[model samples]
Target: MDEAESAARRLAWGVHNAVGFVFTLFWTAGWISLALLVLLATRRRDVALRMAARCWAPGLTGGAGARLVVEGADAVDWSRPYLLVSNHQSVIDICALFQAVPVPLHFLLKQEMAKVPFVGWYARACGMLFIERDNPRAGPRLRREAAALLGAGHTLCLFPEGTRSRTGVVAPFKGGGFQSAIDAGVDVLPVAIDGAGDVLPPEGFRVRAGVITVRFGAPLATGDASGAAGRQALADAAHASVLALLRRSA
Candidate 1:
């Protein structure tokens, strides 16, 4: 696809996005409610997360006609917890990751997500930490929460770019997630996602049914890295790794 959608594609996109978005909402609501109830009743967050990855996520991505291709997953040392860092491309990235990543990925979500109805409940129940990007004062608390989660052996994933790019270019990495990684002394796993933007662009959650590939890169050590400098360096290194993976996949 070019920078802009063609007239013919635009019409198809409208119908696809409208039906897809509505379907996603109702589908998600039903699944999330079931998961939430199970979690609330039995206090099993793992069950909820599993339902999401196994049932809800596939519906979101595959139901939209997005096919996934995963690479370098075997290279990952899944035995230990590492902070997952990936490029932001499209709304499908989340569902794609949920489908691609072998583990139940706890995402660093924006604080505004707390206000979102079913999603908010799901995030909290699953112990996915909220990122208060707009409030600098929330850093220490966030880092503490993040470190606790990591120390407890939960793998986390976040798009350091903060948001999806309209031009389909990878954006600069934000420092918050990296800082959390540094504080926890967790290794950073760099992931590259290609063709997701084409499958589902920024204009709307349109379905293209294209091949979306997720490439996993080697983990960067931040075990001994310290302070603000460590965070920035780790973030830069991870960003570079993601870019290289994208290039290789291209």
Candidate 2:
């Protein structure tokens, strides 16, 4: 590489890491402080959500202010529990989504993340559901857990795609989260996240602050059907919604 290009690349990396570290440090401190206060004082749902909002506010403001441009953000319902399913592009997609919908958020994460240092503990404490991808009974277990959460009237944020897109194109969903929503009789709110891949692509340490739009479409109600055919139907519809948003922006 040329000297100028190499220098620019190095500068980008340095800025990205420096900004990310500072952001994480502040967010972690704020989150732990709020959590402790909440844990000590009260367990009211609104208070808990307020505390979550505080912890999330910094990242949300910084991320959106620097990179994200949200559309259809007003469609999010703060008063009800909806099964929010989105297309995953990169890890920063989480921040974008949280910024868009700053409610009491719970993630349907992979079991692998449950082993991470502080993230796992935080996720577990916040009642995040972790699915073991390899287990034979994982699907059924997740369904049961999801149903319990649904019964309690808590919203869930899930990536039906199950993993980040290697290419920028959205991939097929695993059908587990969809089936759980169907079983629990909840509507799936389709979220389309655009430009996150360009902002922070998978397998890259550098970040390019750019406009990332998150669109919320009409929710899909639970269908009584089951098996491959039923799951595929939901997947197709969800995929179509995201594709439509992307095409519109394009």
Q: In model 2, where do residues sit more than 4 Å from their true spots? A: 1-12, 15-19, 60-65, 76-78
Listed in order, each prediction's TM-score against the native is 0.92, 0.86
Best by TM-score: 1
Error of 1 at 40 (Å): 1.9
Summarize candidate 2's per-residue lDDT along 1-250 as a digit string, tens digits: 9999999989877886678757765776667566756755775545555565555644644643456677776766667777888999888787777667756777889999898765676667678899888997777888899877875778888888878997988887767577767767777788898888877778754566677888888877766557868877887787788778778788
Q: Which 10-residue window in model 1 sums to the lowest lDDT? A: 1-10
Clashes of each: 0, 0
lDDT of 1 by residue, 67-182 (tens): 88899998888888889999988877888888787876798898988889999989988998898877889988988888888878888998989898888788888766787677
After superposition on all CA atoms, what RMSD does each candidate show versus the true structure?
3.3, 2.7
lDDT of each: 0.85, 0.74
Candidate 2: residue pairs that collide: none
* Candidate 2 local Cα displacement, residue 41, angstroms: 2.9
